[model samples]
Target chain A: MSAPIIGLVDYGAGNAASVRRLISKLGYRSRLVNKHEDFEFVTVLFVPGVGAFPSAMEALTKMNLVKPILDFANSGKPVVGVCLGMQLLADSSEEMGLTKGLGLIPGEVKALSSMEWHIGWNTLDCVGECSIASKSDGQNFYYNHSYEFQAPKEYIVGVVEAENPIVSIVRKHNIFGMQFHPEISQISGFKLMRRLLEEFTDA
Target chain B: MLKKRLTGAVTIRNGMVVQSFGYNRYLPIGKPKVVIENLDRWGIDEIFIQVIDRSAKSLEPDIELIDEIATSGILTPIMYAGGIQNEAQAAQVIRAGAERVCIDTLLHINPDEVEKIAKRLGGQAIVGSLPVGIDNNGIIYWYNYQTKEKRLLNDRLLSLVKDGLISEILLIDWQNEGFDEAFDFRILELFEKYNLPLILFGGLTSEKTLKKAFDAPMVVAAAIGNRLNYSEHAVQTLKNQLTSAPIRTAYYHDRSIFKHYD
Candidate 1:
């Protein structure tokens, strides 16, 4: 019954401090993991990212974190990706001309076809009983992204209708992806993170 | 359906929150953290904080204030404006917990720098802020805050939009910035052709006026500042009244579920 030690992956493309701050606010301990060795002692891994796909992939490769993240996701422990971090979980991205991702999940990231980017608060339309969606069912979360995950329909757990239905949340066993920034999504966002730590991690 | 946004804007001056009137007269409204906390609790779609005095004096963004707001654990996505001259400053603001940065003075003076910032941060993170005013002859011009100068809104600036320098446009009506008047509909006409997401701000006080702005096809968000400070749960009240509009309902109506973290 010990508190989980969360490893916040800092690949230089995200606001790791903000995610760490949110973890602290939720009454948990988290450390910024910049190297593969930093993931050794943590029970859960949270990859937080913003900005472009190729740059994020480059940062992870530069820090030698690509193997470690894939290893962690395969270990049957919980690994959560947020925003561009979520997009990075895919096989490849068309953000800046077909950049290869970590390939943890069976999917690819592509540009949203809509003329307007989905930026602001949108309601989470939960389609399954995933722990993150169960806590955040029908609640609004903040989103600011121009690309979305195109995964197989079975892995898709949650979606938001903006111009068209884009994957907002996805889960395949221990690997989870949230296209929205739960840290900045207000109370509902915090609740979803709390559920992920308290329920999903334990399960 | 894509919901229209109801944003609560906090204008900061001299490190204290102020009630800005046409960017001239100001009334202090306590600490910004308190205002931001209330806005989050009220379930506002987003929070826009613009530090008015920083750009004129050439000071850095109020990192201390931004840190305070971020640490305060306000959950709404934050957009910070003012004193953002280059990519580093924009990145700093984002690291300080702002989801987006609005560039007003920099957009006109050094557009190339804006392009650099856009490249560093994604185009979605950059917002083109044009404080505009119309003349008697019905021409749109950029209204400069410090120099009181007016520059025509021409193709050079419009080219920035085409070049993907900024993803969103924050159109400010300089003439009616601090008063309770109707939004300048003419300004909407000028930028409608671009088809960019527009956030309209200026003199939007009443629910009727807000509805009118939201009714516009191009306006994605309506930002209100002074009016929200005077009342409790102003955002919730406004959303409650404008139920038929595209604005999202306030989720805080059931306050039992939300935890007030100290």
Candidate 2:
């Protein structure tokens, strides 16, 4: 079977280049989805983000991508959000004052109470049988964030301890959110990405 | 648990990889891309790249070099330092694919700019690079290489931490950098007051010294530059020896997909 085309959503938040490079390294083709029409034939959608939460939401709204993203998530396609992208999947965020998120996942993004930011390599404790989390069980993935996803226990697939047990990966049916940057998490990260991509393609 | 990081630093001077000693003497190594690629293949937790000469020559962060490294398709997270003086440069470096930007001279020159950078790029993306020197009496001072100035390390840094200007601190031993001496434990003792996540560097040439630095509860990562230039798979070897520590072991294998790219 041929590799699936991964649509990497670019909403002006940084981190697209690194994710694109990593996808290409996996022997798959990924295109930047800047407009709604770009997602027409894409098998899986990847929302890769870095930077502030408010600005990311503003970019998505300004680009007329908010509705398209929601429609795609509702359409039962595999949607993966990374880092700030993952935070944007929540109902709301406390960063820069209660910014509304995409609300696809049942959660809220809150700032970590730790004095030190969660900025390093951290391992994920798998809590479910989600393909990505199961493969990445007890494996270290690179993380650089100040806010974390606070969701119901059933929606959480993986977690990491940083001051408290914070949600690191959440899976709700076809929609998946990873708090860490799998693109830069070295071999294990690539394996997780490949597994997620394979799940979508095989589905 | 948050794994303690083993970062491989690649110091570049005038676009060529160099081994820096005391931040003054430099020995030329090979190309930086080659070194970075090897580090990525060895499964390093993170990569720190610093262009040592950019600030001395009053040049900007080498955008071309950054673009080259970013497009090289290395998968390890990269933290870039040197010549990042403003918020625009910090944004540019992140856009070029660096995960974090380290600021040294700016911490002493204009700390407000550092705060502005943290606000712009988020605190996690900003790192305070404090190159410190110790006197015989065990007093710690910020060592400025360009001005040869020494300012007493004090509450000013704590203010930065309080204001969320920097998420992590890259503590460098100015007096013992690039040398085979042991890391000054007194500096670690002094920094423990702040309780910030520390990335300790300088004079850490062996596992013994690295373990000593890692033993400190505040230290979250340890970086090595000059010594890594001499050998291949240096990071992997070091990670193997320090397995009991919080450092992540290399998970790359023959069946890994990255081997296909290699």
| Candidate with the greatest DockQ versus the true structure | 2
Off by over 4 Å in 1: B253-262
Lowest summed lDDT across 10 adjacent residues in model 1 chain B is found at B253-262
Candidate 2's TM-score reads 0.95
Among these predicted structures, which one has the highest lDDT?
A: 2
- Each model's iRMS: 1.7, 1.5
Q: Where is model 2 more than 4 Å wrong at Cα?
A: A1-3, B250-252
> Candidate 2 - CAPRI tier?
medium
- State the displacement of the C-alpha of residue A111, model 1, in Å, after optimal TM-score superposition: 0.8
**Could you list the CA RMSD of all candidates, in the order they appear?**
1.7, 2.0
B119-205: candidate 1 lDDT, tens digit per residue = 888888988888998888998889878789998877777777776667778999978988986578888887677777789999988
Q: DockQ (Cα-based) per candidate?
A: 0.63, 0.70
Q: Pick the candidate with the highest TM-score.
A: 1
